[model samples]
Target: MAKRAFDQASQNQPTDEARDAYLEASRAGQSQPPETEAPAAPEVEGQETSEALQKQPTEAEDDQQKLQLEPEKDQTEQQQKLQEETDKEHPEAEGETAAPEEPETEPVDFSILKNGTVNKGGNVVNEDGKAVGRVTEGILKHLIGKKVDEKGNIWSTDGKIVGKAEPVSESERDELLKEPAPFESFPDAVVDKDGFVVSNGEQVGKVIQGDLAILRGKSVDPDGDILDKAGNVVGKAVRWEPEPEPEPEPEVPVDKSILAGKRVNKAGNVVDGSGVIFGRVVEGDVKRMVGRMCDKNGNILSESGDILGKAELVPEGEREGLKEGPFAELEGCTVAKDGTVVTPAGDIVGRVIKGDAKILFGRAVDEDGDILDKNGNVLGKAERWEPEAVERKKNPMSGRKVNREGNVVDEDGNIIGKLTSGDLQKCSGKEIDDDGDVVDYKGNVVGHCSLIEDIPKVEEESPEDKEKREQAEQDKKLAIQMSVCIEQCLDKIRPICKMITEKIDKAERTPEDERDEEALVREVKPLIEEGGRILSEAKGIIKGLDPDGRIAANAKHKSAAREATPEEHHLADVLKDLTGDVTQCIDNAKRKLEDMPHAKKELNPLWGLLNEPLFQILAAVGLLLAGVLNLVGRLLAGLGLGGLVDGLLGTLGISRVLEGLGLGSFTKSLKGGKKKGGGLLGGVLGG
Candidate 1:
């Protein structure tokens, strides 16, 4: 029963025989006691019997079972061992044990995927957020779902340590991921993190809109498609080529044949074959023409071309021969080249002998031996010439000579007037009739010319006579200069004298009852003072006349030695007279004023009439003194003692006073009369 039940249990288990043997052995061991007897079998069903068999076992039966199970047990042990080896070899097949629960692992931090995708289009970036290389499809497949270690190293799903995760800013990561993983390839160029295309560390261009690249100012697509700024395709990029250098131009030659047969004139003009001036030769050397006119061969030619002499050499005035034409007649006659004078009708009048045509007919002849008519036109050239004699007539009343040319001469051979028609015309514009009387003029006849012998011709003077003549002329000029000086001095004195006289006369004319003594003194005082100034000026003039004292001393010495010239003696006498006269006049005028009834006494207003006679005498004396000085000055100047004249007239301010007195013309004459050569007063007066 136990066997059947065991068989039944093994059949219900797996079909493994070794496992069934081991299970039967295990049942036998458990059913049998250590010393139990065998038991009977139950006549029940297979299931109830198997239950009973499992519930109780007999002692004898237990022993029998041990004996039987021994070999089976060995076999079961071997099979059981084999089966445990099989279960070890195939734990998943049936009753495999659950793998020992692995320790609960922490969730992987895939935060690196938040920064960028791990795909073929991604970049393998470095710590700086710069792509070191592209994320290839193989690299992406190896790296997907991978976690980064604390060191940023990424391990692949296949356990490979592939890439690293760099913790970059959000913006930087976004910027890096905007472009495709594998950037466009350009020769010697790459895109930097800043989207600039760099070559050999220099930024050559920029990447715009993530993929549009700009190079050399032109837009370029990732595929190297070149485009305009408006996004229109223009062309494709090509390899760079350098431009070729330009070639030089060839030089041209100059033509100088144009200058052939040409010559430059002195006027710098270039002349051609026909002697026509073309242009000027500003530079370079060339043959020059000689004269104004030239032949075709460039030879100098005369004006008429027949003459060899250059026309330029002829004098302009004589080129036309004689200005006067060949006349038909002259002086009532014409002359042939043979010196025969003929009438206008070709009749032979006379023959010129020895060129003295005047002898033939008393015709006029020029010094050139040319016969002339009365109007001085040349009739013909003569071989020789002589002047015609002039006829003279005598004036019986005046005994003066008159000539056909109207000159009238006195007996002394001095031309006094001209006789025109019947009247004698004087230089003064007065006429004298042939009756020896002044005609139609108001002048008395001071004298009449007497008949005298003809004057002899003047001979050449001797040296001594010349000296005397020159000395006389010098003395006359000196006399004139001195006279002018004295005249100017008197001119200055005259006005003061007149003013004094007039003032004194006015005082005298005043009625005694109406006379103001103070007024009379006031008016007369200035006049008296003025008279004193004139006296002082007169003294100064006398002193200036002999400023060096040489003239006075020389005159005195000459007079004592009796060696003085007549002029010198005269000068001394006139100077002495003038000095004495001026002194006496001044003294008398002073005495007259002093002798007044109240002259030296203090003014008594009551004695106005007494001063009247005194002023009148003073005025009369002043007027008389002026007249006396005038006479003396005129006499001294007339004597020709002008060398003693002083520049005191100008020095004492008398020239200015003369100008004011309307004697300006006289003063100007005196100044102008100063000789160019030094005179007595020249150095002193700035002549």
Candidate 2:
């Protein structure tokens, strides 16, 4: 076998040499064609250096060595003795050679070997008296199988020897055993049932029956050689055994509740344990149901890292049967254990170990038990886990401050059913007033949720009970208000009735509603006008009613001088000045009467002609006239009257009287004046 292997290598020597030469040439920056040669005939074939080529001595030495194949006589004699010893062991063998026990003049060559030749077992001998070796698969394989003696020479199983091989220690032997065996060096025991090389109980790689081979590492080169762990030439390799893709990591089990109403954020992320978000959460979805949250820009705001983010909570059972690894899991809509997530009912439950974020679907909830959007809007109704009336101090962070079935308190300390947006949403069993509606910061009502209490035993007649209840409430309120007002007016006017009753000789009765409203006005008008005048006169007497008033009035005048926006105070000042002018004129008229006593005689007859008293009577008469004029003047002035008659009356005392009278009339007229004049006049005069 050794001789045959040598012959085959020698025949393919030219090709081998060419491959080697091309490799060498490439290293030298040269290009050369690959050579084809026969598969047998051994020779030392290679590119020789120019010096070695020019000498031609190596060839001459080869020829001389060929001629020297004949061994000495003594060596031939020793071979014959060995042949006899071999024949003695197998005496009945045909063509057995029992060589003559004498030296021949022509020395015999022993290096020649024939097919099936054998010396003892399968060891082959050449004609040059050399034991060549046994034949095997190839030189490399055979060399690997051969055992080396203490002298470092490799000996075949048949005792044929070859060149010395490198020595290895027992430690080296263990290391080689640990290292994956080369494809060609595989022992029969090394193969598995699949014909793959097994090492340490695992199939290291496979070997093909033909030229193709696959080694340990899953790498293939252009030359079809598979590399082993050490990156050495292991075999005439084919494509690497495709590593059976690791059985997809078994997926982790997820909870079923997580999937029931899994919520995610706008970016479709779930919430993490820290209440940080991992995905975008859109609006309207229950934020509490989302395990994770994200901003609109797809920025995950969780404790996890980039590229390999730890999924927040996902729906339970969503990661069913998934394994763990960076790339092992895809972004399936499944939740894993240890992931944080929210439930459909807005319960925020944390994930268990071995969980993922895929379990959640939309919107995210926070640890505060509030459902929030990516845009930070509170999601859905802010349902408290418990009632609002409980002691808040005990479980300050317990999302529900009250017991499960009690009232809830909002941030504003209002007892609400469920609070939202920093305000009270509902107060159980309480009626909604005008201020009960929920509104945005701009005071616009956004939406509403209703609260109703089932009144046991008191069945509602229909759904219209709300309207009935509301109307009944309003009517009760108005009735109470009307009773109080009527009682107050009666209390105030009772005394005045006695005074007016004795003055009348007879009285005509009229239905309360049919009585002339204008006559009622006329009867009260004089008093209102008189009261207004008195008030004006008192104001003038007081110098300044309040220090702030004078300062305020001055400020108004200054403002008018600056021509700022038209103000009520500015108009009031102009009226006040006219009143002052009117008051001065009235004082001057009084003084003129006192200065001219003779004029009273003329005035007295003039008064009689006029069907009124003069002097003291005229003063009283002037008082009434001033009251009427003051009212008319104030009315016209207030109506923005700016005419010569207004200016003249303002210069006279009548303008003050008019203002006093008209100020109250216009106010009373504006106020539907029925009770005010009657009550106020009686209060002042009676007091």
Candidate 3:
């Protein structure tokens, strides 16, 4: 404020007249380095600038002019007005004419802000009224077409107003000079060249396999974020959805028997040892594939691009130029001249040295009768396996047999079942399965065994013979039903008979003094009643089966007409006599009991013999059965009914002889029954 600047600039010191020329130099478009001066006072910083001096009055003018503050003056204008007043008021009071000197400085921390100054206006103004505009945040970035100082402190408007100047920041200028910037000015996005897969701009996982990606080593939904097993979000999923489930691979049919054959020649043709081509590798290499069905290494393309099977893994050591790549794992295996795929172990897995071979289910197994997998687990047994048909001269029932068609055949030439591998079971003493097969002890189906019905030599019959056969079948069924019902009735009858026999024994064991007629009557009545009912039912059933009394309906009353038609006629005659025997026994006991009321000292002795009626009834039944069987033997001469009857009777475990009756010695009784006096009643009751 003391040393006032004039309305002219400092001259080169040629003369006082040079002042106007210096002022003219400051106005012209020229750049000059600022004069290095001591640090300015807190105020009046604008008065020290050369531009201010160039606009100020000279000292002579300053001595005469008076200065006053003007309202609405900015910092710069205020400094100018105050400096003029100070110099005119106190011309030589301060360092106004001090000698030029070098200024000292230190590297002090630089701050764009002044102490206690609020930076609300987004600028730092020095005392000299110069604004420091840097792009600290958002200030002065859009000052287009203007130049900024190299230090980014000052803006140049090229003579324009400071506030209205369109000055540009260095960064903005640098951006303009660069190639057209990417569409994003700031570009908040970033990328990491690695395959951190993204979906909808969110990271999901990283690629591991060629087609697979994972998050935290686990699968994630590609359409969303990767969730941990607990459902916490680990990351977002990448947008790689599995390729649209490629249309399901088409199923291609390939003949599997081709695998049993020889390796193909280099020309892809299967040749014999003489090099004659028997077959050509139409699709896959014969060295890799036995046929279209082989899955050994290499494409099995039919040139038609139909994939028959997947390329199988060849052995590690033999993969190099091995022609029989398919047999790498199977040592000692060879394609026989007969097209048998023989293993090194002297076993054949399939047949035929070339083309398709049919390895029989029969005779293709180890001695243990077990079919083992490669891992040695028991898959099954090829029990009693047989050889080819030409070799099958031995009895089949002696063992289980397998056929070429993979069926298990029993010794009787019947197909009992099938097996994927050879049959491995014995055929002795096994029960027939529902499938008409004799299963091994392990329950695996062996070959088919002959059924009971199949054991008969059933020949094609004439129409009349067919009718008889049908009748025989019907009779057999009806007989079975009748026999079962009779047994059930017998089961009921036997208990009653047993009870009566026990009562009789008790009566005989008791002393005559201790015997009671009332108690005996009560006990024997129920048994006699129930036993009578059972006998009646059994007789009714026998009659239903043989209504004509064992004689044919067409038989006349005389001559050969008296010939018995079936043994069932004998059965009915015997049942009638048995009924009479029971009735007479009951009548005799009742008569003896009536006499007990009068002769009180003697209880009826009839109760002691109550068991005789049961024995008589049973003997009569035996006689009936024996005569019927003998008559049947004569009636069905060549019809093969004897064997069937035997089988059905076997179910009851009954034998050729009746239990109480000696049927073999009944010859006299049978001959005598023709005469009325010597009937079944007399013979069975031993009269």
**lDDT of all the models against the reference?**
0.41, 0.33, 0.40
Off by over 4 Å in 2: 1-339, 343-347, 352-529, 537-543, 547-687
Report the candidate with higher lDDT, 1 versus 3. 1
Which digits, one per residue and each the tens of the lDDT, describe model 1 over residues 1-687?
333434332211212443355443343222212221122122222122111112333454432221011122333344444545545556674332334332343333434434343333334444555533222112333444454544445556666655534343344445555654221555545445555555566655555443333334444455545556788765444322234586766655433334344545665454555745544443333233333333333334344554222112123343333344222233455445545655556555455655444433545434344677677766656432223556645444344444444455657766665443343333123334455443344555422232223334469999979975775555444334344444454555556555545654565566656655566567655655555555445444434544574443433222122233444334434433443333333333344444344432432231222222222221222121212222334444554423333332333343553444233544554455444412313322222
Residue 248 local lDDT, model 2: 82
Q: Which ten residues in a row have the lowest lDDT in candidate 1?
A: 44-53
524: Cα error in model 2, Å: 10
Worst 10 residues of 3 by lDDT: 65-74
lDDT for residue 515 in candidate 2, whole number 0-100: 40
Better of 1 and 3 by TM-score: 3
Per-residue lDDT tens digits for candidate 2, residues 558-638, read 212222122322322333343333333233333433423443233322211111110111122112212222233344345
TM-score, structure 3 vs. true: 0.24
Q: Who wins the TM-score comparison?
A: 3
Q: List runs of model 1 lying over 4 Å from the truth.
A: 1-360, 363-485, 557-596, 599-687
